[model samples]
Target: MTREKSQSIASQKLQQKVKGPVAQELKEMVPNRKSHQREPRSKDAASNSPVQASVQSIITQIQNGKPNVSGSKETPEDLSFVMSSIFPKETGSVDTSNLKMKPLDYERPDVPRLSFGLERVLFNPGVYHLRDPRSRVYNFDPYLGAIMPVSEFDFDALKAYITSSKDETLAGIARAEKKKYIGSSSSMTSVLSHFHYLLSNWRGVDTRMMSQNFPDHMRSFTRLLRSPAAMFLRYQNGSYAIDADKEFDSANILMNLGKSMEKLLTLPKEDFERYRRTHENKISAEEEQAIPEAYHYSTMGDFLMRSQLDAYDPRLPGTGMFDLKTRAVVSIRMDARNFEHGLGYEIRHVQGGYESYEREYYDMIRAAFLKYSLQVRIGRMDGIFVAFHNIERIFGFQYVSLPEMDQALHGQTDTSLGDAEFRLSIGLWNKILDKVTAKFPKRSIRLHFETRDAQTPFMYIFAEPVTNDEIEYIQTKNQAEIDAYQRRILNLEPKDGNDDLDETPASPEKPAANSQPTAEQNAQPDAQAAYDSSAPPDESFLAELEAEEADLFKGKEIMAMTLVVKNLVNGSPVDRPMVFRADDKWTVEYELSELQGKQVSRLYNACQTRREKALSGRGEDEADAASNVYIRRLRDLAMKGRAYRAKQDDFDSKHGTVVLDEDV
Candidate 1:
């Protein structure tokens, strides 16, 4: 058997021994039972079973009185009972002697301090002006309605109502107020009434909970029914009264609406942009603008209103303004084909094709970071670009790390960021503070970038130092191997059919016969000649020459075989080739005579064996260690070449095939 085959068998056996029993056990425990069957137990019953005697002994001890002890010690049973029954109650009582009650003052405090920055501007402008005296102008409503009665609008009561209201609604109102003043209408009144009703009847008929209990289709139908009611409340201006019981029953509808709105708000800006861009191509500009504006006002009005109330001073340096998004990271990804095209493969006028593409990506990121820093006071920043080839794999990245604006100017790669090129670019900004704390003695600023997919070319920037020793080590090893392989490839000499076969001097008669053939003799090809006159007799010639050529020249065929080795970690391929030369003995007398007379068959067999060993993963050096013994055997056999048998049985039983002899 070949060494490779033998090794494979051994490996299989070892793996089977290690994993066979465990696999079998798993299969048995989690057998392919019907879905109705109970789930399998995680532990074995026998292993988990407690000793009956030990349990009885413990029980008996617990039941019996303990030996006398000085200090009090609670028994396990007594402690269990005490813990089970320890419910405490509040008496709602106070000590009259310590409590002092003072007359209430209806007047407001002499000096009012503004806890929130925007309160002065919002209140001073009289933005709360209302048409109805009953409709008070509150900065934000704790309840859905602005018409809470004075009796139910105390500080604690207001807080409880607000706390109980949907968080999304409160947030939406806050956002809306921030953008524009919120006004009351009939729709708002209905919404307030419905919200209060729902809160009152919260115990029963919750449509949201009911939907969760029902199938998907049913839930969807319920949602459709509830959507109009929600929209009416958000947009309609009609007075509508909701029964308290009915409100409680349908509380789930409001909750679901809030959830849906939250989800809509959470969508990424890029996704929104993509949707808007795609739709813009299909619809007229006027229609597109109208739809978004109407949709925003109808659905997001509350949020916009809140935003107006909580506005911050945009003129102040470092103040984050809503419209200013300069410091935010932007990511770019390119497929392999697009990447190549951008590099100037299609437009050959550009010199550094791939490199130019990489540089462009870097420049874009740098420009974005710089712009963001200037506008938004970005302390550190990153930009990322990802390039993809085939979607499945074959992707790489180019990364540029700029630790800070200063570092970027100096053109130095940061060492504190991660070694991953994609991460260093995009996520660097997000991790700047973390990296700074870990690396610098004093606090410092940083930025980072990261790419999501591995199957694309990517570029990113980072502003932190990160050690990359592991990456350098891998690169060094690969380079070393590649260099060595190149040297070996270059050193291989081209072989000729008539090269000196041995260093030993030929005898006088042999030397005389070895002289160049006469013109007439050469013109009349000798069938017994070892070298083919028509062939160039070099490696290049041999490469072009097929098995048929060997048969035509040597009156026998040559065999070739290939074996592939792969690196287990990275899945890189390694190729190994084996060649054997053979010919029929009768047609070529000199070749057969030389082989039989010098026992060449044995040497050929030994070489084949060594080739197999090397192909089986044994290093070339290991195979070479046995070369001397094989060569000596071959030398002895080559001397008796003519006496060799013609039958396949003799060749097969002695040596498998011709093998190349290698130096130790």
Candidate 2:
């Protein structure tokens, strides 16, 4: 027997054994879980336990691929009763089973995807205006649409709803397991992992009775994980919401957006000329700042209303990510260049400890957040996504030491307004860290930061700095690898030694109305436009021109029908030559070697005689005839190019050599 076959059989036997005794114990524990909570144990203490051993066996089985995961087996429909039986009142008013569920979909090109970091301004204004319409209690009413003002948004109420929904989802899974949701064809190890994750963290979710129904349990568990309830529990925290004054209202945000849009649409020809005359530079300072904000708001509004969800069903909701707890789509950005923005200037680390200093930009950060929060309040934005570029490379993953945080919190400072504001921001951040540590006591802050790093350039920041051990694999790469990573992340090309950086233009998200290209035109590259590194090169790109030329000559047959047309008219004023034009039909019908030797000599002699006669003081009738023949030959050459393109496209598609567009 093959080694793989032997391993598969062994895994099957082990799984069968787990169903015998341990399964019964797991099933019995669920009914009595309310009496007590399991005491936390160190990894060492639990390493040798039977449950752990069983889990290990299940992992092995998955690795062997004895069980399949794609097919689904029906499980119990009502798991909510399990949780409802324990916490009846906490389950809230929302019907967990009826709260329509959908699969998670993240890919959407039109929806602004930003990373968490400094230059967040690129998308922050739009994020500050995002409000979820599916949410029942937050800004949405399910039927009525956005109904509540930002001030009316209650975090506690939102959390309660998701919590209740989660309990019901877990209950459904438990019931499904009891009824045997795991299909006979399902891969045992793959299905078991879902239960293992829940069992490790949550007690009373024993599915041992349904050990035979591993498939069913896995499907239910996956559904629960994709639900809004799971997303809220995983991402929402102290840093999820911006702290702003009670009187602040984000409603003005919409007004600001409207004004910005109006300014863009209302520009006149005379105003353009006046502005141009007033400033010799292409754009004035005010216009530079105003244009992006206008684009941001306009793009945000359109996405909210029409963006499609990342799912099979197109009608549910747009793919704008929402924090169920806060009801906002967090906009993100990464600014690796500098930490000059925001309230970062107040505290600086020197000599392994943080030192306090006052800088002109201290209030700059505070005022920015205040304004941002005000917009968040009005727009109902939930979280801020940011990435500190070069942070991990410069300071390592664990840059913010606990001592530094403490120092920033209590260090002495001048009595200036900026310094005072900085202190307040620091104190709030400290409290946020405390909440994060308490909420996820077992998780390492460093790991969380690393995982977030992996999601950089498009990561959303909850109101706090939370770290987990799950670092993206890319984070481990060295400087050279990082260069490749940056290129991929930004969809940029590697800089060759001879690259000229000066000619590159900034890539604008949206072109002006007059500058907008049609879909057909945009789909094909223009031979006339200058090269744009941000965009894919035109079809006849210079880089590939040589290769195309080589391919044209690759075949043994180089020429088809060699036709030499000579002008037989007398001399004319124009100086012209007998040209060679290869038609598509000629290339298809004849070989290059077939048209060589005698054929070329005969064609060349006829062409010279005709050319001399056509150029001599000729009759108008003869000259016109010669001119028509030249134009017809030129048309035939153009047809050859078109035919080549058509053939190339067919071959690429048939051979699966086409490049797919990524959702950038």
In the order shown, what is each candidate's alpha-carbon RMSD?
40.5, 35.4
User: Taking the tens digit of each residue's C-alpha lDDT, what string does model 2 give over 49-164?
Assistant: 33333233333333333322211110011011111111101001111122211222223234223211212222222121111212211221111111222122221111111121
Give the alpha-carbon lDDT of every model.
0.22, 0.22
TM-scores of all candidate predictions against the true structure: 0.13, 0.19
| Per-residue alpha-carbon lDDT of candidate 1 for residues 1-664, written as tens digits (9 for 90 to 100) | 8544543443333224323432233233332323536455554331221111112222222323232121112122221121122222111111112222121122221221112122222223111211111332222211111221212211111111111012344345435334221222211222222221111111111123112223221111111111111111111111111111111011111122222222122233332222222334333335424321101121121112111111123332222121111111011112111111112111001113122233232333333322322211111123211221111111222222233321332122341211121111112211222222333333211121111111111111122221223212311322433333333222334544443312222212321211211122222223211121222124443333333232222421111111011111112111110111111010100000011211122122222222222222211111232244533333333233223323423754685432122222
Which one wins on TM-score? 2
Ten residues in sequence with the least summed lDDT for candidate 2: 450-459
Note the clash tally of each candidate: 79, 44
Which ranges of candidate 1 are over 4 A from the true structure?
1-281, 290-356, 361-369, 372-406, 410-664
